[model samples]
Target: MAINVELLKKVCEAPGVPGYESKIRNMIIEEVTPLVDDISVDNMGNVIALKKGRSDEKRAMVAAHMDEIGFIVTHIDDKGFVRFTTLGGFDPKTLTAQRVVIHGKEDVIGVMGTKPVHVMTPEEKNKMPKIKDYYIDLGMNKEEVEKLIEVGNPITRERELIEMGNCVNCKSIDNRVSVFILIETLRNLKECPYDVYGVFTVQEEVGIRGANVAAHSINPDFGFGLDTTIAYDLPGASAHEKVTSLGEGTAIKIMDAMTICDYRMVDYMKKIAEENKIKWQPELLTAGGTDTAGIQRMGKSGAISGAVSIPTRHLHQVIEMANKDDIDGSINLLSNCLESLDKYDWSHK
Candidate 1:
């Protein structure tokens, strides 16, 4: 199956920082409304879309977070430079020389600026960069900047999605790509044995807040988290360091820093992928967690949980990339898994 690059592009480009996810949440609601039996937004802003199954004896929840790493305006300097604090984790060096959009009264474009290397002393040149050292230059004086910008505004990376070779690259691919995958899965999934709750969650980048709330309410029996995983298949990485590789097809999460995947779910996913002939790889990341952690344990009685992880390169940076084939495989795998949940045994091995 071919992935929808246009939809993926729109999803990846939309701005929705961790605590400020209104923009992306609205877009998700619009796109997913017609594809499910029923949909509603929670008080916490999670878009829960339910696709009724053949029977409601069991419930399955799948989470794809809509929030991305971004910045919140802290202060404006006397010369019009914008000072901000990160809304999520960031590699400090990635902020250098990047363009960002500040969602103030009006959208304002700014370039991240720091001291020029030409003027740096030897100690400064050798030291690693820090977030405090950067400020955004909006090309306007203080008076003009104050007219349109203020503290508390959300700011997001300003990169547009584009196809490169056989992959798509853009900002926010860390979790937005999974947003695309979940939307597509909801669109393609057929009748299943249990209700399928496709939840486009918010504030996942900050602490899995949205997924935690949704899971508590739904208390699903089975769960799947849709998110991207590291793909350090680059030049300097050793074979063992490559947690996953692009174009290796969708990844079946074994474990990560926050949650250890249920062994039963892992076996079920692997069995399904092999039986369906979907190419897949195992992901055992030692760092970073996804909404899976919330879905796995937040529900009453807990849930058997695993994750479908898209292999992403340059994760958390503006140049995040993922293979189109891998994305399509993710959609295929998730749709099949949701539709065939009744075929598997729930008995503990």
Candidate 2:
């Protein structure tokens, strides 16, 4: 089946930052309401959808967080400049010269302003850019700025989905790619070999907070955390640290900074990819983590957990990109895995 590129475009551009996911959440609720057998939103704003299987064999949970890294207004200065506390991770170097949308009284467009290089000293030029050095300039004076914005307004990088050759580029692709996978899986999925929980979680960028709550509630037998991993396949990085490259295919995680995957779970996904001839790569991220860690450690005995990551480039930036083929490959592997869950020996012992 053709992946829903139009639906994906809308999802990617949807406005939702960490702890402020209403716009994205409502959009997701609308898209997925009809596809699943049962669905609910938890206190944490996690959208949980369940599709029943032929038998009550075992529950398999897949998480794709809906939140993106963003900023919240902390101060509106006298000169109409806005200072904010970052809601999630952003390289200060990339913060400068960025166009952003501040959700104040109304949506206001602003640029992250920084000192001009011509006025910098030699010492300042050699130093790294600090978050304190940057502020959102709404181009309004103090009176107008104070009247329009508040101290707690959220701000997000302003970007529209851009199709670049065979790839799609935009912000929030880190988790939105996974969200797309879950939505399409449910839309296309008719029968499951086992009970499936598709969770579109909130606040993953701040922490795996939503997933933590969802996993505890479900106490799944098997868990798959879907997310995007770094594809440092650029000019200067080594292949060893490239993690997973774009266009290669889906990523089967072996290890990352947060969790060492269960061997059987890793083997399970990898084997499925191989048998089905789905393109995939083994991911070994040296840093960062996904909800897989939180899911694996849930309940008293915990659950068998693993991950399927979309190989992506320029993670956390407005220019983040992922290949169409890789997205298709992940969808294929996960749907196939869900349909054939009973076919595998997923015993804990």
Candidate 3:
């Protein structure tokens, strides 16, 4: 089945930085409301949707964080330059000459500005740029800028979602694509063996904060983390360095910097994918983590946790891309896994 590009586009373009997710959270609530038996927003702003299963003896929690990497306003210089601190990890080089949207009293567009290479000294030309070296140019003086923007406003990349060669590209695809997958899975699900808690969490880019709170409350027996992983299938990448590849398949997470997936959960996911003939690959990211960490260890006794990772190119940048087939396969795999949980032994070897 073809992925829903329109819905995916809306999800990717929405602005929702860590600690501020009302926009995306509201969209998620609307999308999953009819698909689930019950839904509610928690105090921490995580959107939890419940779909009852045939047997409620065990519960499963699936998390797709709503927040994207962004910046919070810290200072506005006299020249109307916007100085901000990053809310999540970013490659400083990506900020060069990029456009951004500052969400303040009203939405305003600004351009990322940096010292031009032509004016740099020989030593400076050879040095890599840092986050501190960049600022947002609002094209207004301090007086004019203050009317629309101020300290504490959030800023996000300004990019529109576009389809290119069977893949969707846009900002926030790292996690928004996963949010779309979880919503679609819920819409397509038939019967689950255990109650499914589909959670659109917040603050994942910062520290997996929302997932920790949601998982603690749900205390699920099984957990699935839905997020994106690097697809370094570029010209210069070595085979080993290509963590996963675009259009190859959805990735079944083995381990990342912060969490080692439960061996049983990993095995079960692999088995389910094979049984259903769903295309998949193994992912072992050396750095970076996802909500998987929180979902795995936050529960009272901890849950058997693994992740369904979309293979993304140019991750954490405005041009992130993911294949349509991989996205469709993810929705299928997750829906099937939720329905067939009762069939798996889930025993330790």
Residue-level lDDT tens digits of model 1 in 1-349:
6788999999999999988899899899999999999999999999999999999988999999999999999999899999999988998898899999999999999999999999999999999999999999999999999999999999999999999999999999989999999999998887888999999999998999999999999999999999999999999999999999999989999999998999989999999999999999999999989999999999998999999999999988767999999999999899999999988888887
For candidate 2, the lDDT comes to 0.89
Model 2: ten consecutive residues of lowest lDDT: 294-303
Sorted by TM-score, highest first, which candidate order results?
1, 3, 2
lDDT of each: 0.94, 0.89, 0.94
Residue-pair clashes per candidate? 0, 0, 0
Per-residue lDDT tens digits for candidate 3, residues 1-349, read 8889999999999999999899999888888898999999999999999999988898999999999999999999988999999999898888899999999988999999999999999999988999999999999999999999989999999999999999998999979999999999999999888999999999999899999999999999999999999999999999999999999999999999999999989999999999999999999999999999999999999999999999999998757999999999999889988888988888887
Relative to the true structure, candidate 2 has a C-alpha RMSD (angstroms) of 1.2
**Candidate 3: where is the Cα deviation over 4 Å?**
none
Write one digit per residue (lDDT tens) for candidate 2, span 188-274.
776887899999999988889999999999988888999999999999998687988988989999988998999988988988999
Shift of residue 329 alpha carbon in model 3, Å: 0.7
